[model samples]
Target: MKKNSLILSVLLVGITACSTVTIKPEGQNKLVNKPTYQDSKPFYLWGLSGEHRVDVLKVCNKNEPLQMQSQQTFSDGVLALITLGIYAPHTVKVWCPKEES
Candidate 1:
């Protein structure tokens, strides 16, 4: 029982190692109500082995975000750590500026 519990605890830690991070344009506050800016279609699965895969999201140090809003999770890295890279999937969100009339 103790061995099983230990394994479960470790797995939990590994899975949670990767978490979502959100970034917004400078001086732009994340409002409580969703904005009408351009946003990436809801996406799922982001890893080498996942069904739907895309480049991992990253933030450039000292660089501003290209879009107005961005959010991402390094699911691939966490899955690789937990499953020896056998499984990896990432989830991301992007919001661009709205077009002016």
Candidate 2:
């Protein structure tokens, strides 16, 4: 009984340890009351192996984000996996030229 309880506790800790969230463009802020969403490009998240913690900073570091795809997860005693779909790649680079502009 004690061993089972110990295992369950550990499992619970692992399951909810991470979560997924998405961000959108600044312009989209005016489109609706709630601007943010679980962003996706055109692909689907089938066979989800783990959690997908989202961050917009991901876009800036990489190119325009193939299929605008980004996700993260801790993969079973291994490295945290980051995956993105490459259906469509970015053509032009867009950046905030001015912080206010």
Candidate 3:
């Protein structure tokens, strides 16, 4: 039991220590329907760290909604990646949603 408890504690600590991300609403906020296709949705900026991704739907001004829209949540990250011109803040990021598959 002691060995198991120690391992579990270490695992939890490692999981908690990850990068965090920030998001901003670019241009205008658009409404989107989530996993369900037939309901109201909210304008949102999805914040992801590393290579994480999510699908978002948005309706154009005079057209129906579009799906699988991609937006950049890491402007500073890209700069940091190319060189050391900019520094991306290190933060722990945890997505609250679960994967469907």
Candidate 4:
């Protein structure tokens, strides 16, 4: 019983620690229903350290990012919970337009 409560509390904290957002550029007449380019990587050590490979031109095949969407996964949440905020990971997704020639 006590363990369950502790785990639940840990999970909540882990999830709340991460940031998530979905936003589009303003004043752009064109609107995309979904993100054509996306990327995700693991954040470690309470997000103090992680590998981020979301380079717009190289990875997303775009000149600049137009919008971004991000969310934390359940497995990541569980891992963070078990680790008690020592090992929380996060994922990020990006949307961008093609590079101008």
- Model 4 lDDT tens row, 1-101: 99999998886875665556665678755444666665456667766786665565565564567776666666667777678658776666666675557
Q: Model 2 segments beyond 4 Å from truth?
A: 19-101
Residue 18 shift from truth in candidate 3, angstroms: 4.3
Worst 10 residues of 4 by lDDT: 30-39
Instruction: Give a tens-digit lDDT track for model 3, residues 7-53.
Output: 97886454333343334245634434352222212222222233432
Local accuracy by lDDT, each model = 0.47, 0.34, 0.35, 0.66
Candidate achieving the largest lDDT: 4
Tens-place lDDT per residue, model 2, 1-98, is 99999998887566434333333455543222322233332322332333334443454453332222233333311122123322221111223212
- Candidate 3's C-alpha runs over 4 A off are 18-101
What's the count of clashing pairs in each model shown?
Answer: 1, 0, 6, 0
Give the Å error, residue 98, model 2.
Answer: 7.3
Estimate the Cα RMSD of every predicted model relative to the unseen true structure.
Answer: 8.2, 12.2, 14.0, 4.8
Residue 58 of model 4: what lDDT? 60
lDDT of 1 by residue, 3-95 (tens): 999999898676646655556667767643443333232323334333432232332233333443343345445555566545444444444
Residue pairs with backbone atoms closer than 3 Å in model 2 (clashes): none
- In Å, residue 85's CA in model 3 sits off its true spot by 31
Of the two candidates 1 and 4, the one with more favorable lDDT, higher being better, is 4
Clashes of 2: 0
Clashing pairs in model 1, backbone N/Cα/C closer than 3 A: 46-90
